[model samples]
Target: MNKELITDITKYQEFYPPNSLKAINNVLKWKNSEEELQGTIEALTFIVNQTLMKIIPEGRIVFCTMLERLDGRFVLLDEIQGVLNLNNNQMGKNIDELKNMG
Candidate 1:
């Protein structure tokens, strides 16, 4: 499957109305293998970290907290290192730094 589609799906989540609660499946409608789903969330977390910072810094921090919780439970070692292989974009670098932390 194309990774860009996953990234696009993550961005599409932002278009949905602000709801009090939404299942992750609802947020990511496309079914993925467990690994693909986790990878998509990782991608979203990195992208959101940059955008949310500029738009809503407090929200960015809150989102990061949420990502931290998810990462604690599901993120993998190879996923972190794989981020380093992406283009030298800010989000990629941010993710790489996050990898360094663990």
Candidate 2:
């Protein structure tokens, strides 16, 4: 399972770049399979979901639709990037600010 998570993180690193993706990959690689990676994925997922809740500020219905479109493989880094991009668009509202407010 740990190896699997490392593999996923590695993919994320490739999908992203020299950023948190690398940091996450490094962290996952260093920790023991029995220790760190055990619940790291779930924890990250939870954190991402919480952030999504802050961004949408609505019920799970819309969230589920978005997740389904992403095929259950959405990563926190990608979601944050999406929110940041949206915030930087014409609306010009930072997601971090909204998250902080919540």
Top candidate on lDDT is: 1
Model 1 residue runs over 4 Å out of place are 1-29, 56-102
What lDDT score is found at residue 37 in candidate 2?
Answer: 54
Which stretches in model 2 have alpha-carbon errors above 4 Å?
1-29, 57-102
Task: Score each candidate by Cα lDDT.
Answer: 0.46, 0.41
- Please provide, for model 1 over 1-102, each residue's C-alpha lDDT reduced to its tens digit, 9 standing for 90 to 100: 222212222332453322322367567676566676667666777775665334333233323533545845876657644443344365544544444554
lDDT of 2: 0.41
TM-score of each: 0.27, 0.27
Identify the leading candidate in terms of TM-score: 1
lDDT of 2 by residue, 1-102 (tens): 121211112222222212234466576676445345546665676776566435432223223334444676756777645543453242223322333443
- Taking all chains together, the TM-score of candidate 2 against the true structure is 0.27
